[model samples]
Target chain A: MNPTACILVIGNEILSGRTQDVNVQYIARRLTELGITLAEVRVIPDQRAVIVGTVCDVRARFDHIFTTGGIGPTHDDITAPCIAEAFGVPWSVHPDSFRLLEAHFPPGEFNAARQRMATLPEGATPIANPVSVAPGFSIGNVHVMAGVPRIMQAMFEELAPTLRHGTPVTSRSWYALGLYEGALAEGLADIQDRHPSVDIGSYPFRRPDGRRGVALVSKGLDAAAVCHAADRVRELIERLGFTPAEGEPP
Target chain B: MNPTACILVIGNEILSGRTQDVNVQYIARRLTELGITLAEVRVIPDQRAVIVGTVCDVRARFDHIFTTGGIGPTHDDITAPCIAEAFGVPWSVHPDSFRLLEAHFPPGEFNAARQRMATLPEGATPIANPVSVAPGFSIGNVHVMAGVPRIMQAMFEELAPTLRHGTPVTSRSWYALGLYEGALAEGLADIQDRHPSVDIGSYPFRRPDGRRGVALVSKGLDAAAVCHAADRVRELIERLGFTPAEGEPP
Candidate 1:
C-alpha cells in the first residue's frame, strides 16, 4: 500500500457556497499520479480551534497532510498560527521568508500585516511561491499552502517530488448502455468476491442526447488483477444483454 | 445561530480523483439559501467501517447530516447497511420501497441486487426519488442520497422543505485593485473586531484579462450589521489608497 495522505481545506467561503473549491481536484489528481492514497478531504471553517484540532487529528493518522487556504494576511487567515499550535512548536518569523518578502516589496510596502506572512512555525521549511512573494510552510507531515489555485499548484509542484511514494494505482473503465446497476450487481459481486483485491465501482450517467447508462470501473495497484476484473465485468455486461463500451459514459 | 449541517461523500472515485464532486457545491448552495449553516464536508471512501464511523460522528455533531453516493445496487454500494449499523438499527427491506422497485423494473429484471436498494434501516423514512425508482432513506438526522448529481439534486429539493431553517444569511462583497491583502490586513482586522458578529473573508483573484485584486466579504444573520461592516470594509480599502469596486472582482 502507498503512503496515505489527506487534505484539509480551510475556507468559510466554500462552506457558505460563495466559492467553488478547485484545489481538491488538482491536489487529488497530483497525489494519485504520485502513487499516494488520498484517504480523506475535509472542507472546514476558518476558526483557529477547528483548524488546530483537525490538523492535529489528521496529522497523526496520515503520512502527509495538505492544507489550503487561510494563509493570507487578513485577520480571517489563521491557518498558520493554528497549525503552529497544533504542533506545539514556537511560532516566529523565518529569516529566509522575511528576506524574500523584503526583496519583493517596495520601501514601506512591507507593513506589519504583510510581514506576518513571513512568520512561520519553528523548524519549518518554506515552500517556494512563484505566483506571489508570500511562501507557504511545511511543518512535519502537514504542508500549508495558499488558497489561490495558482499559488497552491506552484507550492505543491515544488514539494510533491521530495515526499516518499509507493506503487501507482491503475484503473480501467467499461461503459454499458441499456444496462442498469441492479441487473449487473450480482455478477459484479461475484467478480469482487473472486478477486477481493481490486475495487469495482458502478456509476450511472445520463447524456444530454437522451442516452443513459452505467460506467463500471475496476482499479487497484496490481494491473493484472484490475484488467482481469474489468474483463469479467465486460463479459458479465454482455451476458446481461448489453454491449460493453470501451470509454466512459457521457 | 442557525441549524447546522455536514456532508459525508462516500465513494472511491472521489478519493481516487477520477470523479470531480459536484454534489457538494449543489448541497452547499442549497443549504446556504435555506439559512442552514453547512459547517463541514468530508469525502470518505466506501469501506464499511470508515463509512459507519464517519456517519456516526457527523450525525452527533451537526443538526442535519447529508450523505451522497454508495447507495446503488452494486457490491461497493454499502452506504445503506453501514448507515443502519451507525444508528444501531436492524436493516431490512422496506415494503413500500420493494413495491416501487417492482413496478419500475420489468418482472424478471427486479433481481436480488435491485432488491438491495429497497433495504433501509428500521424506522427510516424513504426520500422520494423522482429521477430514479431507487429511493434514498432518511434515518434520524442523517439523510442519505444518490451520488449522481441529477438524482441527488432531485432528492434534496424534495427533502429540503421539511428541514428546520434559521434566518437567511446576508453577505456583501467589495472588490479592490492595486492594493494587496498585506496593505489591508491591519484595517480589516480592526473592522473585524468592531463587527464581531460578522464573518469577514478576504479572497484574492486574478482576472482573465491579467488584472489581480482581492474581494472582502462580510456575512451575518443581521442584514443591517452585514451592510455596516461592508461599508467599513469599503472605506478601509479606499483608505489603503485603492479604489473600492462594487461586487466581486472580475
Candidate 2:
C-alpha cells in the first residue's frame, strides 16, 4: 500500500475567500510524484480550538500529515503553536530556526513580530526555506510548510529528498473528440471491470473549438495493466465512431 | 455572527495529485460574496467510512456544509448515498431529480449509471443545474454538488438566491514599495491593535522591476473602519521613507 498522507491548510484568509489556496494542489501533486497517496485535505480557519481538533484528528488517521499556512509573522499565524498543543508537546523557539531568523534580521534589530517565525514546537526539525529565510518545521509525521506558493515549493524540494520512498505511480490517458459519455459507457465499464487495480477516470473536456470529449485516464502501480486499460478504452472510443487521439503509450 | 459555511471536498484523485480541486476556491469566493463566511474546507477520499465520518463531523460544526466530488455516474461517485446513510435517512431516487435526469436522457435510455445521479436522501430538495440537467440535491443544511468546476459553479449559482445573507464584506489595499516587513512591524502592530474588527494582512510582492514591497489589505464589515485602518497604514509607510500607492478606497 502507498503511504497515506493528509494535508491540513490553516488560515482564515483561505476560509474567508480572501486568498485562494494554491498550497493544497501543489502539495498534492508533489505527494503523488513521491508515490505517497494523499488521502485527505482540510482547510481550517485560524481558530485555535478548531485547528487543534483537526490536527489531532488527521494525525491519528493518516500515516503522514502536512500543514500549510499560518506559519508567517502575522498575529493570525498560529499553526505552529496550535499543532504543538494538539500533539501535547512544548512549543518554544527552536535554535536552528532562531539562528535562521537572526541571520535574516540585523543584530539587535529582530523585534517580537519578526522573532515569531522562530518559535516552533520543541524537537521539531526545521525544513529549510531558500526563498525566504523563515524555516518550516517537521515534528513526528507532520510537516509544516509556508502558505506562499514559491516558498512552499522550495521547502518541498528541500524536504522531498529526505522522506521515505513508496511504490511508484504511473498513469495513461486517451482522449476522444466530441463524443458523449453515454456513447462510451458500456465499453468504459467493461475495461474498468477487467482492471480492478487501475483507476479509470473519464474527464469531459470542452476543446478550443467548443467540441466535447472524454479523456479516459488509467492509473495504478502496474504499468502494463494501465497501458492495457488505456488501449481498451481507445478501442472502445473507435468502435463508438469517434477518432481517438494517439496518447502517450501506457 | 455571519452565516458560516465549510466545504468538504472528497476524492482520491485530488489527494493523489492526479487531479486539482478547483471547487473549494470557487465556493469560498462565492460564499464570501454572498456574505457567508467559509470557515473551513476538507478533501477526503471516496471511502464510505471516511466520507460519512467527515460529513457528520462538519455538519454539526458548521452552519451550512457544502460537499463536492463523488456525485457522478461512476461507481466511485458515492457521496449522495453515503451522506444519506450519515444522516440516517433512506437513500432513494428523488422523483424531481429523476424527472430532470429523465428529461435529459429521454425514455428507456436511463441506465444504472445515469440513474445514479438521481439518488438522494428521502425528502431532499433538488438544486437546479442550468449547465447540465442532472440537478444536485440538498438535504437539511448540506448541499451536495458535482466535482467538476463548471457543474459546481452552475449548481452554486442556482442555490445562492435561497441562502441567508449577512453584512456585505468590503476591502481596501495599499502597497508600499521597497519596504521590508521587518521595517514596518511596530507600526503595523499598532494599527492592527487600533482596528480590532478590520483584518489587516501583509502580502509580500516581488515586483517585475526587482523591487519588493508588502500589499497591506484591510477587510471588514465596516467600510469606514477599513478606510481608517488603510489610511493609518499608508501614513506608516510614508514615515518609513517609502511611497505608498493609493489603492481602492474603502
Candidate 3:
C-alpha cells in the first residue's frame, strides 16, 4: 500500500465561498506523483481550536498531513501558532528565517507582523518560499504551506524532494460514451470484484450539447492490475454497445 | 449569525485528484444568495463508515448539510445506504421514486442497479433531478445530491426554496497593486479590530507575468460595516503607496 495522506485547507474564504481553492488539486497531484495516496481533504475555517484538534486527529490516521492557508502575515494568519500548540512546541522565531526576510526587506519594512512569518514551531524547518520571502514550515509529518496557488506550488517543490516514497499507484481511465451508468453498473461491479486490488470509480459527465458520458477510472499500486481493470471496463462498455474512448471524450 | 451549512463531498475521484470539483463553488454561491452561511466542506472518499460518521457529526453541528456524489447505480454508489445508516433509518425503495425512474427508463434498462437510485432513507423527501431521472433526496436537514455539477445545480435549485434563511452576509473587496501583505497586515488587523462584526481577509495573487497583488476582502451580516471595513482597507493600501483597484486588479 502507498503511504496515505490527508490535506487540511485552513481558510474561511474557501468555506464562505469567497475563494475557490486551487491548493488541494495542486497538492493532490503532487502527492500522487510522489507515490502517496491522498485520502481525505477538509476545508475548515481559520479557527484555532478547530485547527489544533484536526491536526492532531489526522496526523495519527494518515502517513502525511498537508495544511494550506492561514500562514500569511495578517491577523487571520493563525495556522503556525495553532500548529505549534498542537505539537506542544513553543512558537518562536528562527534566526535564519528571520535574517532571510530581514535582508530581503528594507530595514524599516520588516515590521513585527511581517516577522510573524519567521515565527514557527520549535524544531520545525522552514520550507523555502520562492515566490515571496515568508517561508512555510514542516514539523514531523505535517507540512504547512501557503494558501496562494503559486506560493503553495513553490513550497511543495521545495518539500517534495525530502519525502519518502511508497509503491507508486498507477491509474488508467476510459471515457465511456453513449453509456448509462445503470446499464454499466452490474458489469462494472463484477470487474471490480475480479480485480480486488484495483480501486474503480465511475464519474458521470454532461456535455454542452446535452450528451452524457461516464469516465471509468481504475487505480492501484500494480500498474498491470490497473490496466487490466481498464481493459475490463472497455470490454464491458463494448458489450453494452457503446464506444470506449481514452483520455477525455470530445 | 447566519444559518450555517456544511458540504460533504463524498467522492474518491476528488480525493484522488482525478477530477476538479465545481460543486463546492456552485453550492457556496447558491447558499450565499439564499442568506445561508456555508461553514465547512469535507471531501472524503467513498467509504461507508467515514460517510456515516461525518454525516452524523456535521448534522449535529450545522443547521443544514449537503452531500454530493456516490448516489449512482454502481456498487461503489453507497451514499444512500450510508446516509440511512447515519440516521438509524431503514434504507428502502420509495414507491414514487421507483415509479419515476421505472417510467423514465425503457423496459429492459431499469435493472436492479438502476432501481438503486430509488432507494433512500426512511421518511425522506425526494428532491427533483431534472437533468437526470434519478432524483436526489433530503432527510431532515441533510440534502443529498448528485456529483455531476449540472445535476447538483438542478437539485439545489429545486431544494433552495425550501430552506430557511438568515441575514445575508455582504462582502466588498479591493485589489491592492504593488502592495505587500506585510505592509497591509497591521492596518488590516486594526480595521478588523475596529469593526469587530466584519471579517477582513488579505489574499495575495501572482499574475501570469508575475505582477503581484493582494485582495482585501471584508464580509459581514451588516453591509454598511463591510463597506466601511473595505474603505479602511483601501485607505491602508493608499497609505502604503499602492493604488487600490476595485474588483480584480488588472
Candidate 4:
C-alpha cells in the first residue's frame, strides 16, 4: 500500500477569501512526484482548538501530516503552542534556533514577538527556511511550514528526502474534441471494470471559445495498467467517431 | 452570530494537483457577503465512504454545507447516491428533473448515464443551472453544486436568496511596502488585543520584483470596530517609519 498524507492549511486569510491558496497545489504535486498519496486536504482557520484537535486527529490517520500557516511573529501565529499542547509537551525556544535568530537580528531588535519564531514544541527539529532565517519545525509525523508559497516550498524541499516512499503513481490521458461524456460513460465504465486496479476519470470541458471535449484519464501505481486503460479510452473515443489527442483538452 | 458553513470539495483531480480550484475562493467570497461564516473547507477524493461520512459529519455541525464536484454524467459521479445514503433516504429520479433533462437532449441521446444526472435524494429541491441544462440539488442544509466554476456559480446564485444570513462580515486593510512583520508584531498584537471583536491578521508578502511588505487586515461583523482596528494598524505602520497604503500591497 502507498504511504498516505494529509495537508492542514491553517489561516483566516484563505477562509475569508482575502488570499488565494497556491501552496496546496504545489505540495500536492510534490507529494505525487515523491510517491506519497495525498489523501485529504483541509483549509481551516487559525483557531487554537481547531488547530490542536485537527493535528491530533490527522496525525494518527495518515502516514504524514503537513500543516501550513499560522507560524509567524504575530499574535495570531499560535500554531506552535497549539501543536505543543496537542502533543502534551511544553512550547519553548530551541537553543540553536534562538541563537540563529538572535544573531540574524541586530541589537535588541529580537524581542519576544520576534523570538516566537524560534519557539517550537519539545523534541521538534527545525525545517530550514532558505527564503527566511526563521525556521519551520517537525514534531513526530506533523511537519509545520510557513503560509507563504516560497517559504513553504523551501521547507518542503528540506523535508521531502526524509519521508517514506511508495510506488510512483503515473497517469495517461486522452482527450477528444466534440466528444461528450454522456456518449462515452458506458464504454468508459467497462474499461474501468476491466482494469480493476487502475482509477479512471472522465472529465468534460467546455472551452471559452465554445469548443467542448471529454478527457479520459487513467491513473495507477502500475504504469502498464494505466497505459492499457488509456489505450482503451482512446479506442472508445475513436469508435464514437471523435479523434483522440494526448494530454488534457485545450 | 453569523451562521456557520463548510464547503466540501469532492474530487481526485484537485488532490492529485491536476486541477487548480477557483471554486473555493469564489464561494468563500459569496459566503462572506451573505453573512455566513465559512469555517472550514475540505477537499476529499471521489470515494463513496469518504463522501458519505463527511456529508453526515458536516451537515450536523454547520447551518449550511455546500459541496462541489462529482455531479456529472460519468461513472465517477457518485455524489448524489452517496448523499442519499448519508441522509438514509432513497436515491431515485426527481420527475421534474428527469423530464427537463430528457427534453434537453434529443431522442435516444439521453442514455442511462445521462439519466443519472436527474437522480437525487428523496427530499431535494433542484437548483437551476443556467449555464447547463442539468440541475444541481439541495437536501436539508446541504447544497450540492457542479464542480465546474460557471455552473457552480449559477447554482449558487439561484440558491443564495433562500439561505439565512446575519450581519455581513466587513474588512479593512492597510499595507506598508517597507515594513517587516518582526518590527510591528508587538504593537500589532496590542492593537489586536484592544479590538476584542475584530479579527486582525498580519500577512507578509514578497512580490516577484523582490519588493516585500506586510499587510495588516481587520475583519468583523461590526463595521466600526473593523475600521477602528484598521486605523490603529495604519498608525502602527507610520510609527514604525513606513508609509501605510490603503488595501493590500502591490
Best by DockQ: 4
lDDT of 3 by residue, B1-250 (tens): 7799999999988877777888998898888888898878999889898999999999999999999999999989999999999999999999999999999988888899999999999999999999887999999999999998888999999999999988887888899767878887888899889999888888888788878888888887899888888888888888888888888555
- For residues A204-235, could you state the per-residue lDDT of candidate 1 as single tens digits? 87788878789989889999999999999989
State the lDDT at B172 in candidate 3.
89
- Summing lDDT over every window of 10 consecutive residues in candidate 2 chain B, give the lowest-scoring window: B241-250
- The local lDDT score (0 to 100) that residue B128 gets in candidate 2 is 84
User: By descending TM-score, how would the candidates be arranged?
Assistant: 4, 1, 3, 2
DockQ of 3: 0.72
Instruction: Report the lDDT tens digits of candidate 2 across residue range B68-95.
Output: 8878776566799998999999989888
**Taking the tens digit of each residue's C-alpha lDDT, what string does model 1 give over B28-83?**
98898899999999999999989989988889899999999999989999999999
Cα deviation at A105, candidate 3, in Å, is 1.6
Model 2, runs deviating above 4 Å:
A106-109, A246-250, B106-109, B207-210, B222-224, B246-250
DockQ of 4: 0.82
> Per-residue lDDT tens digits of candidate 3, residues A167-246?
77788889876787888899999999999989998888778897888888898888999999999998988888988898
The TM-score measured for candidate 1 stands at 0.97
**Interface DockQ per candidate:** 0.78, 0.54, 0.72, 0.82
Residues A215-241 of candidate 2 have per-residue lDDT tens digits of 777888898999898889888988888
Tell me the TM-score of each prediction against the true structure: 0.97, 0.92, 0.96, 0.98
Worst 10 residues of 4 chain A by lDDT: A201-210
**Lowest-scoring 10 consecutive residues by lDDT in candidate 4 chain B?**
B241-250
Please tell me how candidate 1 rates in CAPRI terms: medium
Between candidates 2 and 4, name the one with more favorable DockQ: 4
